[model samples]
Target: MWTNIQAKRPVWLAGAAIALAALAAYHNSFGGPFLFDDEQSILHNPSIRSFSTALTPPGGFGFTVSGRPLLNLSLALNYAVSGTEVWSYHALNLLIHVLAGLTLFGLVRRTLALPVLAGRFAGQELPAAFVIALLWTLHPLQTESVTYLIQRAESLMGLFYLLTLYGFVRAATAASARGWQVATVAACALGMACKEVMVTAPVVAVLYDRTFLAGSFRAAWERRRGLHAGLFATWLPLAWLVATAGGDRGGTFVLTPEAFAGYWLTQFEAVARYLQLALWPSPLVFEYGVTPVTAWTQVLPYAVPVVAAAGATLWALRFRPVAGFLGAAFFLILAPTSLLPGITQTIVEHRMYLPLAAVIALVAGAVMAALGRRVWPVLLVLALVAGGLTARRNADYQDEFRLWQDTVTKRPTSAKAQNNLGRVHFLRGELPEARQRYELAVSLDPGSAQTRYNLGLVLDATGQPEAAIAQYAEAVRILPYFAQARLRTASALLRLGRPAEAVAPAVEATRLLVEPAEAYFTLGQAQAMLGRPAEAAESYRAAVKHDPAQAEARLNLGIMLAQAGELAGAREQLGEAARLRPQLPEAHANLGIVLAESGRLPEAVASFQRALELRPDYAAAHYNLGNTLLRLGRVEEARGHFTAAVKAAPDFEAAREMLERLR
Candidate 1:
């Protein structure tokens, strides 16, 4: 019993060390704000804001087909618990990552202890597994997947992938391991709900069985046909998800020889880059610029190492099957992204999250085999260096400004990074700085409609309406189907008093499916400017219908209904607008006007008071309140309100005339 306890202590201590190291490395990341896709996937995504919507098929704003239901559900739970505080989400991401690292430790240890590899790794399994897991968890390249809130999809999927493999290994080792086999299949299904990358789990598991447990593919299949069949059948959910859910509009499955060749060549360079980063792991970037290989000459430089790797993998399969298994796992995990065309991004670090496990395992095993007992001190030094680097990387994600600044610094040619940096400036109200960044982004990627639109937004904010309109026009020209750009053009035209010009783009915008509410609202503004109240009212109603929480739309619709003598409808719309946005004085003031018109004197007085309480300098609210008070024969109060309105707005002739009359 004493010997058995002594043998178990090292494993427990190792697990504890991994957990503590992960927490320490990610301590700063817990406060990191949402960056990039996190805004669309979590922050502004209404679908994950509620439990019911999160559990159901995704709908509402920001629902991308890449919407992983299980990942979304986790985010929803975080929202429910902490309500967008950022800390809870980061904590959960770190927890998932730690669990994945633990699972990796278990899987690798079990694999090393198997009959096939046990002889070669005897008495060194624990240390080798611990080193691999430690290196992987602390590696700087993993910060994007672990610290960036939105990339939780990658880490979460990786966790399930590891769990599935670990369960399979456990089942293969045990005499009656039906429960472990069932757990493995369940884990595969769960992984499918997390991300599409889980599609490779079943294949990797079968390969693991063939290489380590059953000695060959045929033997593994022959022994566990039913179990293998169950594993393959789990792909049904994944297939259904891919078919039904809207995939990223960027990637395509269609393969042309030319396109395939270019993508394949680009991936070779990417693989070389990944290997470099895996070894050095410095100056990690958030985004990488895509550079496709258009010619064979461009591919020649990268082809050598890729070819060497392929030959080594083939050679290992015949002589050293374990190495082949590791090699196969690395390529199989990377195959989806590498071979796929239209991936938008050619190289991304987070894509290496799963593949790194195999490389780390092989490296750690080689180191242990060579150094024997002396490997622990070397691993300790490496882990400390890697953990320190990881912590520093997490600090870069402390906020969007720091994150994008670092991204642009590292990847200066990345238009996305420049544009996002511009967004940070724009959000801070530094219009000139924002414009400069936007200009840089536009110059870098002249064909990107988004960068052009971003430039237009800064131009409009800086009072250059014509220049803004030109940028918007360029954006629309570049991407003719861009509804938001058309809407922006219409808005800029309206700002420049060209209501007639605004009408065309505004109408065109309403025809597009994207942001129809915003388009309809812009159309209503243009129509109202052109003296078409009836059409404007219809457009406003459509805007409100599409987004019920659109307080500005509801307020405009109410004002239009009031002008059309539909007082009851006006009252309802204004009341809803006020309820939706309690802080908007305009909503309360408009509600007051409709109430006054409908002869609800007491409610009108209360609404006007509420509006004034929200905005003490609101001249219109004061004026409307004065008129209501004068009608109710509150002579002194009416005079005071009229005076206040005239004081708030010196150009208010109506308030001046009303004050004189009241006196």
Candidate 2:
């Protein structure tokens, strides 16, 4: 029994068993409408919001850091069908994490060349791999990376990272056995399609060859030179070098030589930061911001030698200790994100997600190798302690408010954290608090479009439409294709009774395919107010076609259809809209209009009652109900609704018209 339990497979199985246990401890993101980029990432994201849109070339879904069109296409598929259901998104994230966990295990097991067989009968082989992957899957530090729906880029990107590494392992094995290179090439190509971040895979492969493939350095380098060159040649992922992108294009700082120097200096600080977090992670945050580092003078270049020498020393000193290779692997994988110029922050905990496995593998392997006969007692205690810490850490990610609030508390200087905290206040309708937070955010980051846009929203809520308009306008001026900014501006114009002035920009917004349904819906409302019923009807029809599930859009479409004398078509649209959103007062009210217009007075009265049930003070629903009742000679019922309508909106023209007739 002791002999069977002492093997590599047993350890892996034990780790997997622990991970599976962790999954059941709490539901993944059990409640969330959406958060952060989920708006564009899941629901309004054009890639996912539209069908028949190409994902490649001049005009495509290019809202990515890695220029990965296929990943965007898949996410678009997620949005189109699932439509922001938290469970669906959570489930998908969970599934990807699971696959990644399994893949990590596979990669580690294969990389170690552990002697194991595949079967319940055969049992676990690579115990260290099992420990590594297990630690990876259930580590609390990784909860945000795996659970945040919008951070699909992190998890999915890491997946390709693993694939690229795993492919290198497979290629090395095949080469050793004197097999074909096709599998290796195919895997690398697939990794690129998944994420351009895997561009470092070739360099990693070369190092991996030197570290693990051969017992000696010179032989391994010789074996992998051709493969490394081939991989490097094919690794042209980031073809463009645009400095600023996304909404408001507050964009990244310019990459000047001085900036480059600061960027390089940041790597040492980041290296220290990551190492610190790896040992004792605390005060985890979603946003490290555009300024996570300070400018570095030439005097601050001390980190270059420290990190490099430390890594070099570890490599040079690892005669028989696998710890050297493990440490080296962690540094190699993490170097790109850490050493790069473009990443917003100088340090992030999630950046360690891909590399943590190396630490786990090394530590677990040491434990196994050192105290081979008496390892069980030590391993058990370590698992419990690690698992406890992980569980405690994950509790923070239960919701955005808690997470962001904690972030600000922990890292008060984090402007991004402040902005996110303010967003939480705004989303929750704490307007005064929201305004205060937004003001703080803007003060901290004057150039941030996000903060400025948010400030505009708060201003609009306080009835400062002109100021709000200016902010939104500024946002658009900075970020020419910001859909939310465009929509906000157009909606503000409509509210300000300048609906005609709202049309062209709204149309342009739709033309840019930035939330086309929202732009069209808002444009339809503007055109309707401008007395262009025909044009309004066309816009509303497009809105419904773009998002059939939008009850409000369908309600507007039905009203327009009825006005255009298409009663049957109008009724069908409104009825479906009402059925889709039984709680929506407008859909029921619109259904009543189409029903009454088609001379179905009794049915129209019922629809109006449903509308009033949802929104008792809805003047249009009350007015329409009154009209229907009056038509049916029910003076008493008609009088009640007419009175109700007049109270709901005293100055409402339609309500006034109905009440006067009823009196």
Residue-by-residue lDDT tens digits, candidate 1, 335-405: 88788764346778998899988887777777787777777888878988999999998888887898899
Q: Whole-model Cα lDDT per candidate? A: 0.85, 0.69
Give the Å shift of residue 178 in candidate 2: 8.1
lDDT of 2 by residue, 363-444 (tens): 6765665565366556656655666666665566667888888888877777778888888888889988988887888777
Q: Name model 1 segments beyond 4 Å from true.
A: 1-9, 55-67, 246-257, 294-298, 476-483, 498-517, 530-549, 576-585, 602-623, 634-663
Could you tell me which 10 consecutive residues in candidate 2 have the lowest summed lDDT? 241-250
Best by TM-score: 1
Error of 1 at 578 (Å): 4.2
Top-scoring candidate (lDDT): 1
Q: All candidates: CA RMSD in angstroms?
A: 3.3, 6.0
